[model samples]
Target: MSVVKGLLYPLPLLIGFACAPSALGAFLKDSKLNLNLRNFYINTDYREGHAGTSKAEEWGQGFRLLYESGYTDGKIGVGVDALGLLGVKLDSGKGRHQGSTTLTSDGDHAADQWSRFGATLKLKASKTDLRVGTLMPKLPVLVFTDTRPLPQTYQGGMVTLRELDDITLTAGKITQVTGVASADRTGMAVAGGRRQSNDFRFAGVDYRTRDNFLLQYYQAALEDYYSQQFLGVSHIWKVTEGRSLKSDLRYFRSRGIGANAAGEPGYQIAGYTPDHRGEIDNDTWSLAFTYAVGRHSFMLGYQSVSDDSDFVHLNQGSLSGDLGARGASTYLIAERLQSYFGRAGQDTQIAQYSYDFAAKGIPGLNVTVAHQDSEGIQSFAGSSLRERETDIILTYAVRSGPLRGLGLGLLYGELNSEVTPDQNQLRLMVSYNVELF
Candidate 1:
């Protein structure tokens, strides 16, 4: 007891004084916090872009305030993190209303204001930590969806433990979700909101043996919504002293149970599914390979889905790049996000190439191109429906000067479809940020 107390007696003081000795209170001169500002532009209806290059010109401004406090301790360590997020209308409205980004509420310009925030309490002991309240769960089981201007947050408690070599364990329960793009918090549920569930639970284990190998397993459940299981394996091996190749394989399977409680009998996929079924079943797989030589790297990946209906998921259909790869953001005039354009034989494939400019004297500059081919839709034919796309993206950032960290992106695309208008698009974006602590 004497030894234990001696060791922990300095905790509170350290926390109180930036991890000082027991003599210090909870105030430390080195403690810090900061504010950051980000300005963004989004325009989807530019006569010079979409239908011309996939570039839609839209814009907005975001403000974030972050605060963190060290712990004051004894046997327990305590800390807090607070965040304030505010997004104001800068350049979004009808005619140029890109999509469901809340850029426009009812046809006119979006309200000039949108904001939200959350607070968290953290406790630490040895190498383990417990956190409660608002969290941005990043684990694969419940990674907060952040494919927008803002990031989504969840209300939950999570535990991370690491006491064994080559192994780590994690578990958590989430009850609600606050979308990064909206002001309201919605209850957790399976895809479509019909198979609603509130008690989101998950647990996982990861192992690494100091080599180029990794293994992972996780299971997640949404009380009355659905259950999912995941398994992953990856590794990198040296082909030669100066050359290596790496491969990653991932698989996920999901089934429904108590998803739809109030929906019609057949429409109980999860508990109260929207369509039909007492359960939901899906399997997804991805195979990727990379080769590295000198300062250059090459990568290739393929992913596919095998189901008549769109794979079920949370209200936001983010899985499966159905919205178009390269961040088309599920808004390519397709009507909604995750709108899978598939038929009985619908398949998607990706081919990409990249170059590193740093090897050639220039830093922070690169280019990439990808093409997607979709067939087996069994539904479209003739000169009315063509399904194919070729995309080009060029990006550069200023490393110094007033524009340090300033980035510019130019994107272009070519779309060919039988029934829809063949469209070409282009887009340009400029943004910067500053920190005030």
Candidate 2:
């Protein structure tokens, strides 16, 4: 069957079973339904040397409804999940809206409203669960980002096995994805590539030792593009009461395959490449240390990217061209608010400090400050460049009151770069959740 037909054919059957009297007992008893209301606003001001616009600003409200039905009572159970998303443009003055994935575009302006619906059919047996359709994977190889008012979604099937003690296994294949600001599903590709790949496959294993240590390994491939492997290790140590330290290390190796390796037209990545050939061959690594005591936490980290090519991941930004299909996340410590710091041959240093207000009688409140300095970025012309960024964020959530589920957040960030335009950004968000069960 075709991909579209396969994805659509199971919906009616699942819905029919959901409405049947025989499936109502256990299905309804353990089911959950939630509605989330989010108000978001963002503003970016270009400090110097911006070609297109001096500023980009937008405001929108999002409504998300999620429903998860309990599996039928049996050794092998079945269930269904559904998601509904809606976004309404509240403000985006003319000449201020950037065609980003945060909002859909209409002609030369932002769309007034946009919405989409998704469904998934799931099955469970013992310690293994399988889900087909509408995925938001959070694995090290791939992550569905939710930095905007609406979150991105993928069309695929994923299987998770947890039958062994202190071990987890995951495997999945993704065919298409709907961008955060788009209602249409599109194929996946890497940065600066215009061709799309429908076959993105991944598998991973995670093992946790009894002594509070975690080891991870994952392999992923974007068919006809690139293949990648990741290795990670993390551990924590306790020094005294309420004092602890954490150490995390991660590494990735990627290489071009198929069309990308053959240097075919429209299949090459856009970045500083070896000998000006746009092929993927890179190794990236990062190490971070964090210390926590009482209400204070401090972190320091360093990251380096190989000079052959930029770090590779599934990014659809350039594939969709001007349709606003952008925004992606990477499993790197240098992924900041304004920059990823993943440029070819780049090295980045990171530092952060955060405080929890619960120790001072203000529960559910926290603030964080972070900074990054990056240099040795290989430009297309074979010269090096540098950039820096700093971010401040504060958040508060009502702990116990009539408005207990309400949350408010504020963020401010600044970036100065030699390769791109200098800019400052600010974001404000308010969110509340309602239980519909």
Candidate 3:
């Protein structure tokens, strides 16, 4: 079914439960509703006219209504969750509507509006829970992108177990994804693979050591595409009052599977290295360190991708040139605007700083600046490929009054690359959240 149909498929159930509240008194008593209003504007000026375009820009307003219900009172409790999303174009022209980034394309222009809705059925038993249906998952092995007007969601079943102290286990299977600007669901595909896969499976374990250390391990597979494993660890130590140090480490290994390994026609990924092996084979690692004292924080990080291929992740854009159904994200700290620093043989270094004006008695205000430099990207072939990006961000929120939940955020970024397009980007966002009983 299409996203619209799937979203509306459960409306009757919601209406029935709402009408007969007495039949599910527990659910009604624990149910909660929240609505979020968001306005977003984005502009990108291509310094060298990459993608054969001088600039891309779009502005839109979004509304999201989320309803979550508490489980019924029983050893095996049942509940439901619903999400409704609407996006209206405020300003977007054909010249600014780049495929799969800001808005869905309508021929050479952008669609006027788009909407989607979804529901999840959930069951709970003791400390474990089972959820089946539309989901937004944030796992080490897989993450859903939500940087646009609407967040991406998946059709799947997920189970979580928290029976053990200090440890949690999670498992899931995903079949389809609904993009942020889409009214239909699409199968899963990798960055360069043209063929879509309906099966993506993952399992993971998370362990906490004491109160300041965490360890994670996860395995994932995209059928006939690639199999991946990830391991991560993080720790924080308080050196003194209002002072601390932190460290984060992550690693990933990917290898081709089935058809991809067999070199089936139209099954190869894009940007393979050294004679176009055309198979998924990569090993990547990243480490980051941070220190914070008073109102200031600083970070230094490094990441390196294997020489065989670019760091790979699920990217629906490979299937088409439309901006509506294309979204992807990664856990790499080096990931920045328009680039993940993930090209084959790439090595990236990062520096960042942030401050909270609350320390200066100005509450609800913060500022951050960051820079990343990368080299040795294999895409340049015989020539050396290097890139750099600088970004600044500001954010604030209203603390009280009728607009207590209102927030504003601004981001400006400049990127220069030897092997890719150079660009300047800006983003302005405003949001308010309200709860309805």
In TM-score terms, which candidate is top?
2
lDDT of each: 0.57, 0.88, 0.85
Model 2 spans with C-alpha error above 4 angstroms: 1-13, 18-20
TM-score of 2: 0.96
Instruction: Please give each candidate's TM-score.
Output: 0.75, 0.96, 0.94
Against the true structure, whose lDDT is highest? Answer: 2
Segments of candidate 1 deviating more than 4 angstroms: 1-32, 45-57, 102-109, 194-196, 261-279, 316-346, 376-390, 397-405, 410-435
Q: State each candidate's clash count.
A: 37, 0, 3
Pitting candidate 2 against candidate 3, the one with the higher TM-score is: 2
Model 1, residue 91: C-alpha shift (Å): 1.5
Summarize candidate 2's per-residue lDDT along 51-115 as a digit string, tens digits. 97899999999888887888887787888898878888999966887775677888777899887
lDDT of 1 by residue, 95-170 (tens): 5553345332333335566667777677778778888878887665666654445567788899898878888899
